[model samples]
Target chain A: MSALDSVPTAVSRPELRAGEMLAEGGEGRVYELVGRPGTLYKAYRRPAQLAPLEALIAWEARLAEAQPELAARVRAATAWPQAVVTQPGAAGGTAAGLLLPRAPRRFAVRHRDGTSRLATLSYLTADPGQRAAAYGLALPAPVSADRIGIVYALARVLEAFQRAAPPVGHGDLSTRNILWSLERGPEVFLLDCDSCERYSPDGEALDSGHRRRAMTPNWDDPATPAGANPTLASDRYSLGLIFLRVVGAAHFPLQRRQRDSELLSIDFAIPPAARRTRSLLDGAVVWSVCARSLSTRDPARRPAAAEWVSALEEVLDGLGAMSAARAVWAAQGGGTPAPSPTRSAEQAADVRVRPVAMSGAGRRWERVRPPGPGLPALPQSTRPAPPAAAPTRTAAPAPLPAPPSIVELARTGLGRGGELWLGAHRATLASLSRAGRRRRATRQVIGCLVLDFALLAVIFYMCAMVAGVLLGI
Target chain B: MVNVEERYAVFPFYLCLDASASMAGTPMESVNRQLPLLRAAVGEDPAVAEVIRFGVVTFDDVAHTTLPLSDLSLVEAVPTVVAAGRTSYAAAFDHLRQTIEDDYHASRGKGDRWYRPAVIFVSDGRPTDDRERWQSAHSRLTDTGWKRHPNILSFGFGDADPAVLAHVSECKPHRAFIAAEGAEPATVVPELLAGLIQSIVSSSASVYSGEAQLVPPEVPSMTPIPVDELD
Candidate 1:
């Protein structure tokens, strides 16, 4: 098949054509256009902003060409800058349009306050039921294992992309930017490509004097102060948030708010474990990621995508292993059998007691076991037979050991001058004192006597000299 | 001679990073550049190459597993580090703990013995959410003797809480935490990552050799920033 054939032709027919302007962007007019096929197009009218957009497009295209593998993972540009007729007396020049891919299907979840939050796949897939179905299998109840595996897999993908050395980025990486595909899994596509810049591995700009306007506030990192250009680390911060939301967890690290609000707010709480076997490792991993990425008041502490990919992979591997183990447990007889609702009530009390005792043993095993059932029922084969009559046996008594005094030592070292002993040895101190020889006489007293003698001599001499001079006169 | 079977099971290293809005500008760029260099250096050593697996987890307002643990050889390209969003340390930590716990259990199922895993957390800002859950999870790891108590090395990029990093690292007073002079991810990440990789490699090698003594490699020095100028 021809390379062009690989492109989906079903989208070729545009049913919507640009009839009138819908909105004005800094660089272009967003027009509602109808095309040949029932496709609706947002025809962009080239504005003064087109120059920067054009540059970004060219740079992204070049990078994509240089690295085909990396480019393959990203959304392909449908059309490039093509000269087209424009209405007379437009702003700068003849209008040019670039056809882009349509966004994925999305829905908004309304909050109690009537505000709506866009519930994208990144957020929706995080729901346990949704996640289990999406992956096409019943995940172990202790979902930590599955989460770790997923994180690991994602990390691997990131690493592979990083190694490819493509100047590629998900310019607008948010829940909206991430699309789920049954075949390809989670695919990240770059949107607002015109506003994105090509970066070297060192984060230096390939093109100078180019800055794109910020797109969406929701997609931007909450920690960012107002009116700041998004940095590479900022993108990482956003990516981290996306990961947490996708993994069926509670709350984003940074809460989204209006631009005028405070940058930092610690309000959200993480979800509790559903199973004793469910390791909090997943939560820790997520926290560490967010902490490292978002905790740095300075953007520098955030790990690069390459670095994140590696770290995430490790976490996912752990999760995957846990899942596998859970699966094994289920397959074996180790899994707790489902309990009846009536029995579950009694089991609840048992659970409360067991957890308290288990906590002392430093094992979360009780938590991992299926809930609503008392501890695993003892197997009939393993149950001990009734104890036989005890036989009498004689034992010898042993002597008791003496108890030692328990005096608490003060944390502070020796007393006021005790600090001197930190570096100095007693022998060195004695030798220095002896060598100085100041102990033989009272130096202060001797010096005073010498000063007194000198003063008396000076006074007597001065008086005699003055008397002689007066007599001669 | 020591057999391969008797060699220590190399624990994978995961660096769950916070790349939120707080880590923009210098910090993100520093980390991005440092990651590749670290991988290259680690890959150069045959011993490290055989045992150490690396991955990255980046969090912002939301936590996501950007890089899952994989062999170093699998990474063909470097990831572009972008800074955006808020700090979500708590969620990221939870994710890390869950992932590690799962892996430990799975390894046991396969009859694979595991060495204590290590997580090096680098962040510049504070968590933008409740951290109690993360703290509890961290405590659980220590109490459970799970994978050699999962070494947690935390570095504060700039203006980060030393106490938090210490609490996460669970290392002794002087060894558990590192504070970066500036918020440049590029500068701090390399230094921190080098130490992490070095520690893992040395620890694993010592375990394999039955020496019980593993001297950590010298950490790369950070570009000195004048103390007076930091303010």
Candidate 2:
């Protein structure tokens, strides 16, 4: 059946001309609307897929009525279709195109060569050196806090997409389609919103057969099979990839690596420098979410956009604390501050947040942790302690060493024996018959037999020495 | 931060123009005028220019690389081509076969991954050489065993033969186009080249679309020459 035959005639139909052509994409031509200053027209090369397009517009309208604030945020960050443009004289007024707000000037960056281009994720996903050479603009370091802020912003947008009644999947969330900017703020503007696939309110896919499902190379979700429709799961998968690539500032295919070997870890995909620099991805909370989202084949295991938002928010908060602490230290003659009594040992160990001296500045301080949203505390034994303060008055007896905190106790307790006994008291007894225990017992028996042979040899040597002395006399 | 060899995707397009004596006056002028627009269209958009590497190859009795494959944004200006000598499809095909292989390895060394190369062939006259010689060169250029064999799109006008143009494009439907009968070279040349600018821009955008395709130009003044169905 023809694509236009399925559109309902009752829908409101706006009109647009061929107009002044601006740019042509793979699917359509973007044109400037005559009277609408900030609005542009995107005319499909083939007849427009009205069902999904209308569904997206209707979905946004419903969102406006229900949640105006969220609707505004989505509208500001994305080029959502404002209306559908119809051919003036076609039968039943066939929809020919869509009118969308133009991507704002803030999203465009001027290169050193004086040509202006949209600041897409392509500018963000490469090395700082290469990006400068190619785009003529130096980007923030891969481990920069601003890069995490950008990922947090993107997660919020995807969270909004998931919040829709049926949810809309972009299907093709790639570097080229999403324009990014940190010029004004950590923001991203989505283009080609009409190409997004919509679902029925009951959570069933309403994708018609007319529109071709879009996916960009390298950015395509490895979990999604060819010819299958895009789903919320796929979108979540894409979001995970964007997070890894953007934060790492390298285009390592995490999914492809996982496909090759299920044992592959996120560490293999992450650059060694990023790992050493202790970027936000190094934290257990954020890294765990990214690992779960990409390293598994089952879509059900992937973390949702909302999960990403929370994780990113927590890490970014930790980064903020680190920055504040650094500033405090820099202000107070650049020295390592002593650990605060109120600071949990895990916070001191994991996040490395040292307590700044309040006596110098005469200001009260609140105890701060690295990140506060239920993050797992990582264990470490080799981190150096802060230097002790020099004695100014009469010498005093040193206090007994402080007892181990619960985290340190747990760590030490776990390490004392190479095995962990869970559940019952008898579990350790049961483990004694295991292969490892057998190997240990066998090694002990072999050691005792060798020791006995050595003792006998010593006795024999002593007796032979006495007999030799008697024969000489 | 990662020292990964991040290779950027590039879509290489070779504009293989027929620069025979017949194309000198209006046809050649139209090409020179329209070629710069391609640079402007691609160079202005860094997103598109990042992935597209374009070159111009002009041929008559002998073929010459008028422009080496390069990023449009990096090129200062496109050099103009002048028409002379009789048409030899053999020279064009042979030159293209050699150039594509050389270019592919050179580009790969510089960390560029390529989509299949696209060859846009434009001609105003039929080949003056024997069919066997040209066909052999064409076979070598389009050999399935060769990884760099380009997808060719043929456009013909004036004294050019539709059958040969069809053969040049391997008789692929929508790949071969001929100017409508009695259309002036001045009118046809401009429209064809203008359409080609849009075609190149659109095709380059497809590289980002996962399945890279060779999009044919929509020349309003021309019509597609239908290929005969094989028995």
Docking class of 1: incorrect
For model 2, give the interface RMSD.
31.5
- Record all residue pairs in model 2 with backbone atoms less than 3 Å apart, i.e. clashing: none
Residue-wise lDDT of candidate 1 within B39-133, one digit each (tens)?
65554332344356566667676555555554453344345556677776655654565556655665566434555676767677776665554
Quote each prediction's TM-score: 0.34, 0.63
Q: What is the TM-score of chain A in candidate 2?
A: 0.62
Name the TM-score of candidate 2.
0.63
* Clash tally, candidates in order: 145, 0
Per-residue accuracy of model 1 over A17-103 as CA lDDT, tens digit each: 565554454456545455423222444544333444444445434534665543433432211222232334555632344445443
Which parts of model 1 are misplaced by more than 4 Å?
A1-40, A45-48, A76-96, A103-171, A181-184, A188-190, A200-212, A253-287, A321-473, B1-231
Every candidate's DockQ is 0.02, 0.03
Worst lDDT 10-window in candidate 2 chain B: B1-10
